[model samples]
Target: MPIRARGARHRTGPLRSPGFLRSLVFAAVAALAAVLPAPVGAQAAARPTESRPIYSYESAVREAVWVDTGLDADGDGRGDRVAVDIVRPREPAQQGRKVPVIMDASPYYSCCGRGNESQLKTYDAKGDVVQMPLFYDNYFVPRGYAFVGVDLAGTNRSDGCVDVGGRSDVLSAKAVIDWLNGRARAYTSRTGTERATAGWTNGRTGMIGKSWDGTIANGVAATGVEGLKTIVPISSISSWYDYYFAKGAPLYDGGPAELADAVESPDAQAHCAAARQKLVDGSPRSGDWTQLWNDRDYVLRADHVKASVFVVHGMQDLNVRTKNFGQWWDALAANGVERKIWLSQTGHVDPFDYRRDAWVPVLHQWFDHYLLGYDNGIERRPMADIERHPDQWSTDRVWPPSGTSAATVHPVNGPVPGVGALSASPAPAGTASTFTDNPALDESSWAANIDKSTPDKAGFATAPLTKDLRVSGSSRVSVTVTPTTSSAHLSAVLVDVGPDTIRNYAGEGEGILTGTDRTCWGVSTAGDSSCYLTTSADKADVGFTVFSRGWADLGNYASDRKGVPLTPGKAYTITLDLAATDHVVPAGHRLALIVAGTDNGLIDPPPSRPTLTLDLARSGARVPFVGGAGAFARATSGARPNVAAGVPDGTPSSPGIPVPRMAAQRLPGGAGR
Candidate 1:
């Protein structure tokens, strides 16, 4: 057996015997040959009979590795080791050809898994990922790239307590990139007694994922790590504060402790109770920004990001909300990060499920151009992909499509919640509109009664448009209000008060549910399932759809961190903004603004209803008009729109798109986009 040639293999021995490792070295040489271009005019049979390849997708090396984050969250004294399971080409491992990495570091690996199909990792006898969740590993690993699945510290097999988005959560994966570039240390085992290294890597890497996984990508990229080249964060949060609160309104009933418990190790809660308690105490239920939230906010330090970014978010995503994407998009743009974007109408769904056929190839090209140094020309392509309808995608040169313009409109009060009109000019001086806060009613339900007298809310709008009016981007609201009570919370909504069949977003279930609906996305193994229930939305008649919304606590209006209660009957000026939008108010539809109390359905209900009076003469809403030529100027100037009763659609129209982009359509300072 010792007299063997370079390519010879021992017929009988341990799988990784000395003969096998040496033969693998030869196989690595053959893998290197796989990437080299063929020589010119040489006889095919006479080519160096290459034994090792430069790269081979199907025959790559697959194994598990541990990265030491250099932190001990549980105080056992050992470095909190992060588990980085890898699928790489063997040739790259043998020093044949170095490969860049595609990483999806997540806490979901052990708890729930990833993607719509919810695929989790499976292990062989040695504990390698036999079934990597979703399609990223299977599709990209075979294309001369290494796919790394990391178990965030404190979850799965990683050693540490889940610190949420704190140092442990963020720095754990940063250590992996550091190790790839030789800046940090890794070990062969969780015990840290043995050594391990990433000698096969090129030190360049890209991170991509959705929700918490994508949030990790954003958090890591914000650290300004040198080896991180790019990131693709889909439906992700740039600020954890935005996830749970708006202005001074808590979006959820429970505090961050519940969230920590939801994503962390079930048994490890006792160890991380202090960290979890910090979240509870910091999020004071009254909805104000705290140091804990600031630490978790990636947007604040986005200026430090050197990674090119790609963002994908759904407009109807109440879970993460479009604001997460909006604020982060603005910051990334302001910081001049190289970027691309995709805006969808789905609710908390991934693009792979919504745009299956086009997403994979586009993603493949994106990686090839950024990570592999390929001249794939993806940079020259359109920067935005927007959904005009479900599955009806259109590519645009820039988002907000160029030529968007903003116009200010004043509210003319009427008797009820949805009855008033929006005037081109300011309301009469000294005129004021009053309404009481009602915690029991939802926004759409409150808007449903245009004719009913309501003491709880006031609505104002413009007459039906003669032609389609496209409203894009966030709208700013400037108002001065006098409250009857010491404290009050204000909510504003921009409604398309037209007779059209809009999406059913009034309830918790934002999408249509299809019965007996079942479909498979990717290949499945014993350890993972790939099929999911098909969903469909059932459209209903509505007076109008609440396209954009905003919230503000009168007490917290002056400062997000500090609250100043109002003196009864003393008016205070507060300027807030509604959520961003890409909606089209059809011809003969009115653009209405509804000023109410807390959004009871989504946020915590206020203690009591406060009768509030708004100074209508000084209050108005600013809208981004992107309809066509002169639409913005006219809407702001002298356009006389007809205020007419809308006709119910004879047939159900496409679910009124609940959401949408950037460039030639960009407004001032990338607004509207």
Candidate 2:
């Protein structure tokens, strides 16, 4: 990664040895030490290193302040003040040694909680933060960096109504960045009239978190705020609309207002009731694109983003969904933003939970390069680190491997009516297959019986692969359907039919089994422990894996923003985009596509149960295959399943990936030693 001199105060000169850099730092500190503010025993300005800690974490300063956001979502007369908890090495303030900030702004800090342990913030007698959640405070503060945890407005110590992803939600976090730069006002206390300022350090900042916490990082970065150098958003949502809806199709019966109500602090309920009401009224069930969604959307404003982005997301994250990252990443690339990504196979999990040993060191280098302005060559490394299988990671210079292209594969009728084969050759024109709506059937049920005829769905499978075939990106299913009713719902599921032992994300633990053994991440304190319960991969033996899926309300066939009711027996062509993915089908596995109505639990059923006829010639999936159509054709042209050719049925069915060895080095956990 080429380093860009982002801030005016930071300079990116020619690369030299670490020893030379330290010497330069010492000389500068000596020349200015007389004029600089130095406490009784403040040491020479400390330099950050990837392997060593030079600052005293136990002696770090800890405090809390309220930054004023110029908004009144709760209809309160005064501007809302957002809570910011700070933990930093004392040397920054005492010795005039400035450091960059690593901040995680979240609404969950006080409500649902954060991390695998679900830890929440704790305060001491003076109302100063005694314990900040997660290992950021423990790890980074000892490395001469400040870790700031911010409570989003309407949650925790912040004052305002939870606006969901609306103005209050986005602006409150942005206000903290502004306060660090002396552009926004803050208070010593939530209701105090006295002012507070961040005078202890340089303003370069990086935001990171998972889920809603990470979502705020994206929102704030999109504001193009100065002093925000980078952001690492893990399992985050780039568009709130995408989170709850898919191309105008609502995944749940509820809307944004219900989410606002769930996370709203108890004290804020009364004041925020009207704000919640507005969310309900503004978001119509009709799935129309409203100002509310537009305001919450960061993709549209991707051009406004100035911060470099480090995106981390699970390929199978159904809650926040993969499209949020997919669309946002594309837009960022289009605008030439500096970016890096880590795509994992787990569903809605933090990398720290699964890949802790690797995650920590990489994260440290990323922050060191971007926030602390160290030329660590992290940016120059591969742009993507993707986990293609269980615990199997590969680095790529570009995602989708360089040669990936969309290849259309059509469904061909077999001797039986409903069951079909997928081929590169187009099916006969006007040929159609029919299936009745089965509101009870989900993707799993549809995929499990792909080769057999069923009333619930029309299934198509390719011949067993002769070689591994990889699908590297999002796919689209286009079909012309004639339905018995004016309104209908359609779904497409892509499955790898074979035997394999994979992460059991569908299980209660959601892919990880927490064990009694505790692994320490950083130093520990009484209020907060850096040691957490160790987790192992929860693997399951499975015959079929649903790798990608898509859903659509046929009424929004032409435009996601507008709905056009269909006339009975009239054919309408609709295309639905499957969630983004990267998966490999082993040689013996058959790649299958199942088309059905009502994904059941995923999306609510349409009012009418419509038996539909699909035009086979016009309907097919456009897949992003690694070697394009040629590779897909060669893989699927073999006469028999590769298993018959001595390929083992349990080729990739290993129990689980072995646990990585953890490092023993520790940093401070929280405040008190």
Candidate 3:
């Protein structure tokens, strides 16, 4: 249901898919009937005018357009042009009032009338269409803002070759924006010329979407197009290599089996296979490829973007790593751009789902503040609002806000509820917990696998809160461990466990109601046998500046044979840093910290073996608290303010990286990559 651009052909008759075409056909018919002048008197006068539906809010209004155009790629006379469709919203303020336009761009053939009709009829029990917002005509049109859904230049109905991450996509977006501005001025409405003029003249256009759409937003923003306002990239990775192929390792060899199945559709599989081959065929170390990837990369130099921004991401998102969000956040901070971020316990697919009513208001507030110029209680809210549990919304002035306290809770020696502390000393060497990594024997090893009961993990907790404790910002943990081999994967989760219910305010229906309960957070990897814990320096205080190898190696650690042994009788710290979040731990709720060598149930298990050792006395965790006098606690000892290690601290680079050259791919109609 992702949006695509409008193309020429009309299939005629009833649509086989649940799409705007069927509705558009009806409207067109009605228009034809009304203007025929054959039926006189009452019948003719009673016919309703073919008008776009309007959704009115306190500050804005919107009208949807269902358009179809021909893809005349070579200016040829033959009927070779493919059919395309698009759904655009006419925003009153954007015309001349100078409102910002928000768009969702993807190559998924979103508007290509395919199986849409059948899909539309299948609604959830709540009567809302399932995944309907992804449909062009359904969501974007009624939002009271200008929304453009394009078919990537050479996919589906769009002409040209499918360049993947090439220049055509970005250029097409720019062209669409220009077209919208002109169309807005030309299309006069009953509201008068002033409204039409204001819609385009006074408007600032921005982009917002997830996955593919998210990537496009970044690309368009990078173009430095005038009036390009801001972007809200959800669950998107800036670097293709870093995100999909390598996160310090090769492609997740055994990760996300579901993705494999999802891509198995003949068409999708073909596209993905080609794309993967392109990745391999194109040299990884090539400056050309690197430059091309970097130019298309959203995170490489986020500072290049001058737009005010807001980012929202989930901690447990297996599809896209949470660290990518950190990269963007840090980039904005480094550029000294005003921004806001929201972190949640949901996954990549949840944010756009309507089951989360909270998002509706939040999005409205954001657009109101930026596009409509209506303060309307938006600025009064926290710069960042995160969800620790479903019922609690924690607010903060900035991300990873200051004022936090750290306390170590031992694993084996830590007292269990109703049980006193068992030991005050560290365990002997090799005296640690272990789990086997037999992917063949494990069904739960798939990516994002969740085990709510008897989780294969250990936890430490603080006593029930004496007062309402709001914990906002990133959370980090340091742990000591020994792997069975040269390399191992480790994952951690921070949960607010108690009698209070923790709702996932993002997912849909049964998925939302019964999805994983833990508000899973950030993750880091270690590549070698070293005492060091891994975390992205990009999230550190000064923002994202590339560090030389002399500073920090931006890769995971690898261990030696016999694995890195945990020093017996010595306590080592394992830091679990959570992404910046907003949540209030109500009085009487305990802040639970769960540490595991793997999050196999919720995500793909690491390709390496892992063993863990916990230090009882010297190891501790940290949590940030804000609000009220004496309501917060300060770090007691052994707690050092987390700094992004290995990066040149506080030094900003100039001009950033240059755009790389890309090799063109050929298309069906002799189009080049």
- Tell me, by lDDT, which candidate is best: 2
As for TM-score, the candidate ahead, 1 or 2, is 2
Q: For candidate 2, what is the lDDT? A: 0.78
Q: What lDDT tens digits, residue by residue, belong to model 1 across residues 1-673?
A: 0111121111111134576567656655444444665566643433332222123444556788888898888777667888898887675456556778999988787677676545677788987777777766555654557889988887888888776676778999899999999998887777757878888888899999887778889999999999999999987878888777777766666655665676676545657776667777887877777788889899999999999998998777766777888888878889989898888766666776666556766777778778876555576788888765545566767666688767787887553333566776788888887888887766765566533457778777665566677887777888889999888888888877666654454333344434465544333334433445555553455556777788778887688766766788888878766777788777666667888887666566666568999889989888877844367434434335432433222211323332231001111001100
Give lDDT per model, in order: 0.70, 0.78, 0.40
Residue 129, model 3, lDDT: 22
Task: Please write out the lDDT profile of model 3 over residues 79-191, one tens digit for every residue.
Answer: 11111222233344343223346665555533222111112112235322223233333422333344444555444434433444445556555555554555322213211
TM-score of each: 0.84, 0.88, 0.55
Candidate with more favorable, higher lDDT: 2 or 3: 2
lDDT score of residue 455 within candidate 1: 76
lDDT of 2 by residue, 1-673 (tens): 2233111011122224586467545544543553456666663343333323445566788888999998877776888899999999886577666778999988777766678787888889998888788888877776668999998888888999887767788899999989999899999999999998889868999999888878888999999999999999988889888777777667767777777776778868878878887898888887778888889999989999999999998776656678888888888989999999898877678888877767877888899888766656888889988876678788889876888999999987865567787889889997988988887768777776676678989988876778899998889999989999988889988888877777876554557777887766555567666666777777777777888888888998889776777799999999998988888888878888889898866776888999999999989999999999988988877635333332322322322222111122110010010
**Candidate 1 regions with alpha-carbon error over 4 angstroms:** 1-59, 91-95, 414-418, 501-509, 512-543, 627-630, 633-673
lDDT value for model 1: 0.70
